[model samples]
Target chain A: MTNTMTTRRKSNLTRGQLPKYTPWVVVAAAVVLAAAIMTLVGFSAFGWGVLAAILFTVGLTGISAAVEGARQAKDKLATCLVFGSFLIALLPLISVIWTVLVNGIPGLTFDFLFYSMNGVTGQFDDAAAAGEAPVVGGVYHAIVGTLLMTLWATLISVPVGLLAAVYLVEYSEGGRLAKAITFFVDVMTGIPSIVAGLFAVAFFAVVFGPGTKTGIVAAVALSVLMIPVVVRSTEEMLRIVPNELREASYALGVRKWRTITKVVIPTAISGIASGVTLAIARVVGETAPILVTAGFATSINFNVFSGWMASLPTFIYTQIITPTSPSNPDPSAQRAWAAALLLIILVMLLNLAARLIARFFAPKTGR
Target chain B: MSKQTSRAGDRIFSTTALMAGVLILVVLFSVAVFLLIQALPAFFADPSEITGGEGFWSYIWPIIVGTVIAAAIALILATPVALGVALFISHYAPRRLSQGLGYVIDLLAAIPSVIYGVWGITFLAVQLEPMYEWLAEYAGWIPIFAGPASATGKTMLTAGIVLAVMILPIITSISREIFLQTPKLHEEAALALGATRWEMIRMTVIPFGRPGVISAVMLGLGRALGETMAVALVLSTGPLILSLIQTGNSTIAAEIALNYPEAYGLRLAELIAAGLLLFIITLAVNMVARWVITRNKDFSGANA
Candidate 1:
């Protein structure tokens, strides 16, 4: 020990002794080594991960124990655990997307996108079940129904939601009514999508008939779900606008109403648009509400005010659970996966568009 | 558009706003009242009037238990990973990557629930069966893990896990936002005192964000309570209640979705009654969450 200490650098002893690339080199070796050994035992990525994790932890701890000592080794363990938590959290997201794509891709096609299930029956679907023919029918009608109902729901929700938000932001002084409105809106935000459907059904059952089903009823149900989201997001956007701008408009001698319309709204319109888009995305995939209120129809119904309508969510649901053919559910399962894929794509686009709109419309702070 | 002419327009617009506010309240009251009226038959029905001689208590006990257990299990499974993701995105990710990671979370949130249902039934359920059997085989001493050992994957445990995956992005996004809002001074002070990166976060960030995180968890819990299709699809219809790892028990939302189409007379009323219960439970949770937020002027973000 005395002879080695004479040759050892004092600077290295006081500072750090391990190489900077030590962690990476050890981690790589651990992973590759664990993978090979696990393959010999049984091919499981989970087993490989567990083995590699143990190797990484013990190996790093041991190496640091020799060089940097105990405190540094403990720090490394904590850091690894933090990183491992992140990876664990990310696992489901990756798995869900990968599984959806792998299973969903085979179900999507030109025929699937364009054609409807107008005349398709169980016997007609049997060919697809045999893996000998392309899947029968498509989600075209459901897509149309989703579009029209969402459009109407948007139209209904936007006006009411916007007006209330305007009141909350521009008019109300936190009076009793306003306070009640705000509290109830928070409560309303938690109402399950199914409960809204029940309300719509009950409303129709009492007012119109016992068994009325229409696209409009579905619209009403969706509107119930959309209003709170719109109000919350729009309210947040409105509050963040600079008060000096509103004051500047007032200083210019603009009427109170004109100031709100010309200056305040134009300033916040982009966020409001994005908020509305997000609210739409939030509800478009709701299955239970539409299943209860609209009832599934294979044929396209253009009008929202009358008759049963099928949306993508319900279409996927009925196809999977009840199936077009009781004897062969493969075709139905395929269609379900396809419709799910379509819905996910639509939602993804809406989210992307919302972000773009929000970015574009945000007040330019360049000045 | 002159001031004088627009006075009437302004008045009308303000009145419309008031009307809209009134409409929201009206809608809430009506949902409660109408559901109550529909559910009255189920509450009042005699044994002679009942289907299968099932009273409201017997009909609803399993569902109530199912709802509580599924949501509780989902919350348990999701909270740790959610907190980890929140911490990572808020404190640890590279500055250039953090914003992109947040966008990824939003993308996860935007994916539809029905798609999750289909995937759970189609893939996850099948993949999870072996693990369930193994748990029962080795860890049967644990009450929740102990099962009748059917080895079927469409059990309450699967429902809980699927619900956890479905709710993950939400709790993470909210908690991440809360952590991001931690004042820099606190974090800097901790780090200046010789704390490691993780230690600084534990000392400053989580304590400051606790209320917000709690509310976020409550919000996730509310979502899990009402989640219908995924639970319906993944949880096999059954009557057992205690052994969630086994193939039995269904939540209230799934119960209504599964039974509503075939229900008649008192049966339909009972389903509506169940729906009402779900609405009340979620509403209570949301109210508490909102109260927590509003209790803190600094955290509420409401200008008012």
Candidate 2:
């Protein structure tokens, strides 16, 4: 008993009064109790279930407080809460990727990738009766449509937004016109995707009479969304360009316009490129605007000036909402999921490419 | 003479750039004006014939109320978690862990809004129904969570949750940058003073980063206010209502999207009016965000 007392004293001296463990013990016992109670009473009552979960967590913390010290246990409780919130944030994202991968994998066969949706039935009975391979559909048309529309949107938005940024940062000198442009661009930045679609529809309707829908119209609508992001990001990049560079170019007898075009733009090109790419990525996922302006078509239309074209977003929407083969929806859903997966892949690639472009083109500082 | 001609050419180039900038502005103003002008006739027309009604208040009041309630709920629920994540990334985590976590958080931002809607419908709806029922039964005193459940699983609460998820990444990322830039000297001073870590964060770090946090919230609010896909996907079509459990009430943008295709006569015009209202709210929110961001000098990580 004397030796044990001495040893305890030594431990207390070394470890600052041997942290209290009673709270932690209590917490543990409470948690076990809560869990047992919860199992006894099923989770059908969400209120009671959530309450039990909370009690369980709290009980664990109390147990830690008893085993460890109150302070250390509090810290542990905080760590758990932070980690829990992080997991809560992550749950949806992980579930999405997992679901898409699992559902999309079945439709990712070589034949599925190569074939078109020309003669596919979404019927399970048909598939069973045939004693053959499952029917297939292709995203080739959607892939092409997405590419064409994105290209057109890029063409329309880049020059306009770039020039506008130039005017705002370089020439306008915070003039009233520049401020007005700034205010409006800020407004446009917040414009709903659907409203942009409506604007494009109305604009095209005015130009091509009442009922006008095509890929070009969709491109215009997307530009309405894209331009604001491009303008904002480019303006920010250009504003960050060192004034010394523009002055150096001017000192070398370069005109103001020449200085802006050659030196200022080049200096900020890397950021501008990434910004423009992000803008594209931003709008490429847009469904409502495309649905409003482009309308849907099952068949591929190469020409933007034609009757109808199907972008990937619209295709996904139609496939999910109104399956042509309603008797069985698995195939249609498979196609939609594949297209959705493809869209996510495309955006991810664009983002990666943007990063690469930024890194490669960013101006290097020399010693 | 050649020099003078060249001067004219320089003038033309700058002039063209200026024209392009102004043209963009005009296009924006025109969009706002066009929507309001188209929708005005419906307001002046007979009330009995109008979809929502002719009284200016009747036409817009329901949607406005619904939009505000959902946006507010989303903003409230998301802001704290976003700030916590931002703090974790900026202050708490180790360097490599923070970097990896940052990328994961940004990945959340990259997922399309429509996918969230799809997930909400297929997965979350079935899972959350019991919780919803409980809220209705227990928290019915709070009118927001009190309403009849819909057959379609599209509830205002669901829409609000999706909007929260949509804005979470934006808020977290922006606030992370802000929190990361908090003045080093202040934090070091608090540490040297033998203050506890939480106390230090509360007293020194937050005060310094407050404006940036506010700006981040404002930016998130703007996105939430204008969010179309998640709202359009989640909302059922009906007059806007206050009940979170009820599924049919729509926001301004969602209403326009649903009604625009088949709308005719004055109905189309009223939809435009609804669009106008959304435009105005979004413009105000963006302006406030921009103003806050511009005024907050320490927010840019210049010192860092």
Weakest 10 consecutive residues of candidate 2 chain A by summed lDDT = A11-20
The residue ranges of model 2 lying beyond 4 angstroms of the native Cα positions read A1-79, A110-136, B1-9, B52-59, B134-152, B239-242, B298-304
lDDT of model 2, residue A327: 69
What are the clashing pairs of model 1?
none
| Backbone clashes, candidate 1 | 0
- How big a share of the true inter-chain contacts is recovered in candidate 1? 0.69
TM-score of each: 0.93, 0.87
TM-score of chain A of 1: 0.89
Candidate 2 lDDT, A24-69, residue by residue in tens: 6645665566667767876445444345446756765666667556
lDDT per residue, candidate 1, A1-367, as tens digits? 7865786756545566677889999999899989989989988987798799888988887888778767677767766766676777667678778887777798899988888889999987788777777777998899999999999999999999988888888899878888888888987888899999999888888889777889999999999999999988888888887999999998987776778778887889999999999999999999999988998899978988888899999999999889889999988888888788888889888888898999987877668
Residue B35's C-alpha lDDT in candidate 1? 84
TM-scores for chain B, listed for all candidates: 0.94, 0.90
Interface RMSD of candidate number 2: 2.3
